[model samples]
Target: MQIGVDPGSRYTGISLFTGSDAVSPKPVAEPAVVRAGVFSIEVQHRGNQIREKLTARAALRRGRRSRNLRYRQPRFDNRTRSVGWLAPSLRHRVETTMSWISRLQRWAPVAALHVERVAFDTQLLQDPEIAGRGYQQGTLHGYELREYLLEKWQRKCAYCGVSGVPLNLDHIRPRSRGGSDRASNLTLACISCNQTKGNQPVEVFLAGRPEMLARILAQVRKPLRDAAAVSSTRWALWKSLTVTGLPVHVASGGRTKYNRHRTNTPKSHTLDALHVGVVDEVTGWPVRVLVATATGRGTYTRTRTDRYGFPRLRLPRTKLHHGFQTGDLVRAVVRTGANQGTHVGRVAVRSTGRFNIRTATGLVQGIGHRYVRLLQRGDGWTYSRQPEQQPA
Candidate 1:
């Protein structure tokens, strides 16, 4: 026997087919002794067993409980400070629905279950307006339901028994023609097989696997025809939660700030400053000393500002002792933002302003010249004016 079970939001439908051999019962060889004497009995118990086995197997294979599960909606809105209290009520509705399905499954052990997948973009669920409108709780989309079945059935292609690659939710009755989104009209299919099937009917596509097709259809139809109603506890809990509104929670974190600053001044320049020069195209060699001056604070050497005004320090030399030497303590300013304060660290190396510096926290590595001040004597020469390191 073949069956097709359609489970829907409002009602479920079941269809079954009796095999040719089982259409009529065969006469039993042994007759029961009765007061009425000779009596004829028609029986085909073995045929029934075969049909039951197929039916049960199909049902077990389609053991998908839910489809396309998404993240739960947060209870509190950060912008509006508004609380969402409708989740509990909607939850109650889902609970009731699930309970009803459980009852049906319990009573119809021989009936197979088929759930149609739905196609809906879940990303839209993230929008508060859309979610609040109640679209999230609707029936699972066709693709989602098919994915659910594939997952529930352990990713084994119902027809080929192949596994691993993702399966597609195929329409028993191709949707391109006129198949509605219903449980009886869907099944799991491998990607290649699904593509080959295209919009073809299930019967046409499964011609090579007639028995499997028959069994799958029979399962879909039988549950609608013979299943008894049963309730689900999970549904009850969900319904209760929906009525009380989803749990609302709010959380926050602290923010930290950073900054850097730099300037150029020389004692030779008079205080009156007859002419103030604006930074006309601040361009220089990759390795250049950025100096900053403070009125009462004396003079401070800082690294050049990056194209974005952010301090970018580069190491000038690597072999420091006699050659820019390592472990040389240098002063620099933070030119990144509002903080624009003085920050100091020791150089671990002197290579293209690239080096490692040991700080109170630990060894700060890859120290760049933009983050350090070069010690110079006169005529822009350091120590003996011998260039020891090259710019990276």
Candidate 2:
């Protein structure tokens, strides 16, 4: 019998399997040849990548050929491909380990244990074959959790109670909205549901649907109860357990091995292919943007769709921005081309050699002095901030 226990501090799942009776039968009362594994683990993590490297350039490019013609190339960290540094903090790892230990102590009695391993990373995150690049920081952990959850649920969603292809592990709360990697906060959702929910709160999507919420709650509750029923002494009965290798390598190794593994580097990492979306003034819908890549150019045209797809061309608009005229009562909205959709202000009052803008809403009062822009005057506004300004 080979039994695997997937354990976490907050949650634990157990699975038991027997080899053919002819091979060996230390059969427990359960007669089924293959039994489904229960999932009851939650991996938790904290810190996140905050300030990422934008870029760094050489002080001077190839100046000119000298008599000897020697050249000095700019140097930077090849792993990150820039001169910047990555300050990886420990908010995620500590919580995950805590969850694993908590589950291991609770659910050992009923489930037979041959080898117990915590899979923190998955093939996509670690396998050089799939990921040609260097060890991406969270690749292993993300992949591992997905694989474990899929297998445990027999590739079915824990919610919706549907089984077929494995469901993706989705966050009940979106990470973008300040959710941490807590197991208690994760759930299995179908691909359709996952995409639809995207970075939004579960409650926001569920939106007062009581029946749907009940189903999802039932799936999570059952696995937890089963795991808790097992006794600790039962787990002690298992013969052997092994901790699986984490996909991410620790920083203990010297720079020699680090350099060797860091062979895969892209020719150049441009900010191209960066998807920037904006609320379209014309359509009243979110519009995809295509920004020009030429240096010192902050112009972006709307993306156009044709036979194949959007052919990486400019978005055409009748109004072109030639710097605002003096006292135009212009809306000094952030330059979309240069600022990349960051809004500065809704209305900026022209002052002595500077735009004096009042806060549009109460929220604007708290923002610091900088980053304010004049609002782009739409069809309605004749005077920028005049009391008469109203919708057409």
Candidate 3:
């Protein structure tokens, strides 16, 4: 069987498929393919874990430098980064994807690998008007425009100037009032402002604040300066996949979307993986898609450290305590307490006999390990829900 993979920063989609002669050649025909199963490997902490750690480390370093200003000599010139050095978090994503592929190879005879190399064309996305030679001359490209807007407006609501709230890209002129989605017409506003100004033109909504309205208009007209193109780590992943010796087939995001639409499948990472390459129409395929969440295996370090790098927790001396390990799916039956009744989720083992159960509702801490029963040993993946059964 051939395996299709769609790798993302947070999740990797995997699909096993066979029977190529089933799909009709016509685009309008009902497209179908037989698949044993499709699933995703969801990174437990996502990329934020790495980011948070880096931020904390930086803060600590800054504090140390300030305290030891005389003792610590500045060595910025001596420190140098190696070529093609990826941040630890991003490298983790590539490594994790490769690890999943290796594991899958053991279970099934993977004849080939299909992967989506690039999801979007950065140049075209940034400058829609630049075609042919204009593409070469276009200054603003990719994420720079978005970054510019965020910085230009000071990451606050244009109307209210409220900071530290969730902001969204908003249109100055309502679409209903003939507004365009161009960068010039776009601005960042807090959720409250956006909802309140819904379907209203900028002038009408900002009538009370003439000075702010003027500032907004002027800022929108001014284009952001050109910046260096930001490179993505997906290219690094592609390079690594090439050395695996397996026949790797590359596809584009456009083709994947087209195949998915023709098949009339719902939007999902796993389903997208299934539609990564050309497929012939088939019949009687199972409708259910497996939603596998990644629960990391227990790390080598058992202790949890504090911000000052002091040991705060020694965890459990034994990795497996009472036949249970951290990340194992468990069902806790608590007879009485504030957290009573049945709670089903992954459990965090403790040497002290008390465990933490992470459930769908939330984390129920301080549950005795005896009350927990192992439902499934975490194999780095958990099928918590099916696509059809997802909440509307």
Candidate 4:
């Protein structure tokens, strides 16, 4: 079996596929059968944790420098970043993906690996009509233009201010009326607005609302800040995946989308992984999709520490409290309390016998451990959701 992986920051899609001619108890009839699944890495404080810690550390340093200026030496040699240095959050994503790949290899005989190494052509995305020497004159590059448009238009129809509607890229000045297909001349409009505004100019269309026209023009000119820090790390992830000693096949984001659309499958990470490459058809089989979620084992630091890195409360010496760990999935039936109902989710074991159950709605704290029944042991992985079936 070969594996197809679509790795993202939070969720990694995985699919195991067997060739058409592969022998089975029941005769095989499909070109390929995809066993799709998603891996959701539940990192405690995932991305925000790193940001918070860095901010806190900086604040502390600033406070210290202000208080003791004479003793504190000013350091000025930390500006440059070394080669191939990835941010903590991005590195965590890569590590988690690799870890899952290693874990899955034990269960299946993975012959090859296919990954979507998406590299967005910022030039093409910003200005789709640019050809030949026109590329040299373009000023705006990267996803900033798209981000700017979305922000300026507030991700809604600029004409009507209607949100949650299917939007389309529309020309403020109609093409028939000599409008250049530049970013400045573009705006997002719902289907209704687009049809209503047919070939009419922005001024004529918004004749009744002069204020709206002024606002739209002003928003179009405003440029968005560059996102160099948020530049993609997909290529780096692709490089890391190549070390698995298997034949690695790489596909682009566009190709993946085209395949997915051709197959008429629902949009999802796992579904995308299943249709990563040139998949024409898979007949006579109902595809099973597994959803894997990461549930961390209890942390080494027992106590709940304060912002100043000081222990706030003493935790239990033993990790297991009444045969339940912090990350274990459990069903708690509260007999009597403010929240007197059955709550099911990951449990946060406490030393005082009052465990915290994280339900779908929110965390229900102060629940007695006696009421919690272990649904699944904390194996650092949880498959809470059932496998999704795709029609043949």
Candidate 5:
């Protein structure tokens, strides 16, 4: 068995397969995909929350120290970050991907691992037309970034297309939302257009003008944050996979694309993962993908804190209540209650023995514990299935 991992910042696609024809003399059937799906995580949002808490904590400390409350030596250089230290959220991405790989290995007779070295090649995607030309800096022709934007955008507002007006460089994705300062994310916008679209994502701002939206985005690079996240975590993920002692075969994004195009495979996260290595033919993939999202084992803090860090609400120290812990997948068979019938989902436990089951349709609350039966113990992930993507 072999595994192909198409690692992304937000969603890492993984496929477990068995290569059939590699050792066969005659033409054998295609590789069989035992399982495939994305491992999802909200890296940016989680990182932001961590940074916010650190900043708030520092502010509170500075406030008290400078208030003449106590005389303490200034120790600004007391600590230093070790080499290769990634932020908590980005680090989580690497750790979680590794954790799932270990789980997958247990389920299959995995022999080798084919992992993409990098998710995107900046040079290849600057322009769709510039393919095979070996263009590095795109179609700038030695002009500056701002000048390039002005000319590329035809000196007009990309959103409104109002020419002959004072135009400002706008971010298709706002900086606050983790957008980068790269040229691809930059565009020309008039003063009115800029303000009207202030801090709002380009997609939401141009919802009414989809044609205009598509035109602007076509010139833009893939979302900068996602690219950055994948780039930052790629090396770390690759390094972790090496310790597994499998013959880890690294592949480039271009090779994955080439294999996918040659095989006429439909574009999907799981499919991309399946096509990540050197291959002649591709087939026999499962129709359904098992989407495993990393929800994390519940937080360590039992007390909810406010902005000032004061405990807003305190809960029982124990996470498990009434023999059911929060996040346990369960089936509730209620014979007589407002939430009658059967419901299957992750449960939110309550001390009163009345839990809430979040199912696919909706939340069924006030479910008695006696009616609930544990289906699977939640190990910090939620699972679902979706049909494989079809070709356009």
Candidate 6:
């Protein structure tokens, strides 16, 4: 089995599969997903939050020096950053991705790794069918513009927000009415919406709903930030992957787009991962994906501090209570209470023996520890399953 990875700033996708004709087994064999999922890395460590914290600390330090260093000599250039150093938040993306890659390698028979690199020049992308009319083919066949639109529209119909349907390339302002084939003038719509909106100007078609119409117009001009993110960390991730001792194969984002379009596969993070490197054909894939969000393995400092570095709240010295620690995956069966069903989720331990469980829906509080059984120990990730795409 080989693993393909779609590394992103916020979500890193993983897809494991065995080739169909590669001397596989009889019953348990095919070009199918062994397992696939995305790691929600932004939940625990977003760059903005880390940057804000650093800025706040710097300002606070300046204030303290103004008060206490009036009689003392001011020190400058006391700290050193090593060569090739990355900001904490940016480094977290690389570290987190490499950790999951290592974890998956240990868990499965990962023969090799395939990872998608940064975007290639538009010149590298070519479609034989649309070679002459380059701009006209962007929404469907061109890699850069098409992928940007897919991320922008979220692989859904822009008009009705309906997904899982083969969307048609739509002109927001009808081309015959004066719309240019620029990227900003384009959107996506379901077949029915496209037919219903034939020849009618967007302003007149959605005159009743000014809000959605305005939102769509505003979103058309929005830039694709995901491209910048992938570009920033692509080389870092590539260098880290080199040390794994696996035959690491790499390709450009444009190449993945080419492979995906050649096979006519729907867009998704995990599916994009599955088509990262060389592939003859994608025969089958799992409908459900296992989402493993990186939540971190609890922190050393238990105190919540204010801006001036004063302790605001102090957590318990002992993290474990009733033989269960916070962040542990547990299933609680309440016999008689408002929460009188089976609830399986991450548990937040309390000294009172009543823990709160964070379920997929929400959080359930005040459940006694006696009813809870350990399902899996928390290993810096929360595991859950979600359908790859809801059935239309």
Q: Which stretches of candidate 1 lie over 4 Å from their true place?
A: 1-155, 222-231, 236-392
Task: Tell me the lDDT of model 2 at 165.
Answer: 56
Ranking by TM-score: 4, 6, 5, 3, 2, 1
Model 6 lDDT on a 0 to 1 scale: 0.75
How do all models score by TM-score? 0.25, 0.26, 0.63, 0.69, 0.67, 0.68
Backbone-clash count (model 6): 0
Better of 2 and 6 by lDDT: 6
How do the residues 1-392 of candidate 4 rate in per-residue lDDT, one tens digit apiece?
Answer: 77777765556776666634433445555444334333322222144455566687789679878977577656897799988888876666667677777877887888878887752345555556664445433432323344446645767999999997778888999999999877789899999999999999999999999999998888777754322322355667678778888888887555566666566666556666666665664432224445566544655655777887678987767888778887888999988879799999888886778998887688898998888898887766655444444544
lDDT of each structure? 0.37, 0.35, 0.69, 0.68, 0.73, 0.75
Off by over 4 Å in 6: 20-80, 119-141, 149-226, 299-313, 390-392
The segments of candidate 5 whose C-alpha lies over 4 angstroms from its true place after superposition are 21-78, 122-229, 305-312
Candidate 3: C-alpha lDDT: 0.69
lDDT of 1 by residue, 241-305 (tens): 33433331111000000000011211111100100111111111112211111111111324545
Top lDDT model: 6
Assess candidate 2 and give its lDDT. 0.35
Which stretches of model 3 miss by more than 4 angstroms?
Answer: 22-45, 76-83, 123-231, 279-286, 294-325, 331-344, 360-362, 373-383, 389-392
Across 1-392, the per-residue lDDT of candidate 5 in tens digits comes to: 78888876556777877665444454575543333322321111134445566686789689878988778998888688998788777788788778878987897788888888764445434553454343334332223345346545767888888997788989889999999877778888999999999999999998998998787777664344345665778888888899999999887665676667767776566677888767777656876777776666776657887887788998888888878899999998888767779999999998989899999888888888989999999887777777776655
- The residue-level lDDT of candidate 1 at 69 comes to 58
Screening candidate 4 with a backbone cut-off below 3 angstroms (N, C-alpha, C), the clashing residue pairs are none
User: Which model is ahead, 3 or 5, in terms of lDDT?
Assistant: 5
Error of 6 at 304 (Å): 4.8
Local error of candidate 4 at 111, Å? 2.2
